[model samples]
Target: MLSGLDPSGGAGIQADIQAITSLGCHPLPVLTCLTVQDTRNVYGASPVDAELIRQQLECVADDSTIHAIKTGALGNAGIVDVVVEFIRKRPDVPVITDPVIKAAGGGDLADDALITAMKERLFPLAEMITPNGEELVILGGDADADRAAQNLMDRGCGSVLATGGHGTGVHIVNRLYNHAPDPMQWEIERIGGEYHGTGCTLAAAIAAGRATGLSARAAIAQAQNYVHRAILHALAVGKGQPVPDRGIQWER
Candidate 1:
């Protein structure tokens, strides 16, 4: 995993590791950004140096059994470029990128340069990029949902799953589009609550599914279904923000 830090462990790499582990995959993570943040909002974030990133990737890449990868909250363009080049060497691994643009609690995660870097470097390297409604807008400024997804395809990802969590509707809708397969839409009722790291958890869950032998489409479906439950039993970990229990079903 590549992501910003979450001091509260309610989001970012902390959440990704938990979600991946809960889904029965061994979680190996690489942190791209260190952040001063609680569940409510981010105070500040700085991406790590590119050399540090390359060193981490080199170390982790030594492990031969890692079959899948997930990325979230890269702090800048430089980090994205380094990661893109690294992944190019392992085109066989399934990569699920959670293109997180803003904090669920309303803090901005990427500036213009970083956003451009994400589009140019990271999106193309990913097998599937997951962006929520707000992120889609940021990823494809002025493009609507369908257009944004298409733009991502044009930019080179094999697939884009543009989640509609912020749109105005009683039912939360998640849509997935592939360059080859027909598009599919999945909807669930909007459970009333504030949750952080939902996107990261979802992406990691998908990666975990892939590691466990599911095809890309089946992996995504399992992830979507798992997210519904994780949010339903979300635990309030901070005064103002909630973290979904990746083990939501463990003791139920």
Candidate 2:
């Protein structure tokens, strides 16, 4: 269920659909929010009609195997409640939550209450939350990636894959943290840009991997690899943002 993005065909549900299809999975989108901006950043956002959101879900739920589910940019508290409740009912499916609180080009997508809702409710329902740096700070209450991940786990996430793409460093550090046990891994790379649709691409790739029968860990790894490759072949499609060449189906 992709949310908090517009149908600009550049990011959000548009990007999610492309990423999912690139991996040969049909994207069944339940848009949770809508935006009024483009590639550069979001200028304004509106949550999708709650009842309409449910109707869309019902339209596809009974007819699909729905191997995995992914969520992005739910900008408000009420909508978060609806999404959390939706996922809660589907416990067996792997839920990939991309906590998008801000845009890559710079903008606020959620307020304190919405952020708090994510921490207290949505975090627990998530199998794994792929949060950007700033979102992590709000959810974890600490800038330290390790500490923030633990805080997310304490809120009930089975795993918190804290993405460090926004953090300052020569290499990007994407860490998968299992709070219950002591296991973690990081991916470092210096070759990436401020690409558009990055979060949607990653989360949808994970969902696509899961739909194709990958376990949580395997799905995460494969999805990360896929997204990395997509970034490597990103295209400057817009004046403000570059879209990943996800259309090119590359192999690793």
Candidate 3:
């Protein structure tokens, strides 16, 4: 379940829903914050109280057999704490976390302390944590992606998928590192334009794959393909950036 809802239909729960549905899995969304924004940027955001989030999570968990979860844009420490609590109960379920530090238009999504809270509390529980280069710098305190991912792994995350969008390169290379045999790497032809909610789409696709019982390596591979296809057909909803068309099917 995601931590926020974006009304723009580009990111947050909207994006999650689209990605998960495209993968043929049911999405169980639990909103922890409400964001006011268009495709351009986040104008304002307010988090739901921890108790309310807890109630929503409890209700969902009780009513349905949740297969997997994808989390994005948790607004604060209180929300992180509550989410961590909920995740702790479902130790067997796979959890993919898209660490949302800033918006596509550079708006702050979480404070420094909130980031710390996530590193300490939530990172350990994640089956995979997808962070862009900028977010890795903040959380891993290292400029090198490999070193940064290692730092996160030491802290407890099962794997780190460091996306190459924020880096300077001719090709976007996403690296998956952890306790696996070796790191899995995917190099894709870099799309020319900036796309909003790509990370959210990737994480949700991974979650859907995991929910359907794909192994970690297979899930990551499938998710990368889905994300690339979505971005290739991204929708230009606003002036700032294109939003991923998560419904696009990757036909062979």
Best-fitting candidate, measured by lDDT? 3
lDDT of 1 at 207: 93
Model 1 lDDT on a 0 to 1 scale: 0.83
Please give the distance, in angstroms, between residue 201's alpha carbon in candidate 3 and its true position after superposition.
Answer: 0.3
Best by TM-score: 3
lDDT of 3 by residue, 1-252 (tens): 775788878888888888889888999888878988778888888988889888988988889998998899998998899889988999999999999989878888898888999999999999999999899888898987778888899999889998886566678898999867677888988888668888888888899999999998798888888888888888988777889899887552
Reference-based TM-score, model 3: 0.95
Tell me the TM-score of each prediction against the true structure.
0.93, 0.92, 0.95
- Candidate 1 regions exceeding 4 Å error are 180-182, 250-252
Per-candidate alpha-carbon RMSD to the true structure = 2.0, 1.9, 1.5
Off by over 4 Å in 2: 168-170, 180-183
Q: What is the C-alpha lDDT of each candidate?
A: 0.83, 0.79, 0.87
Q: Write the per-residue lDDT of candidate 1 for residues 1-252, one digit (tens) a residue.
A: 777778899889988988888887788788888888887788788888988998888887886567898989888888888888888888888889988778876778889898888888878888898998888877866467788788778888778888866566788888888875567888888887657888888899899998888988888878877888888888888787677878765321
lDDT: which is higher, 1 or 3? 3
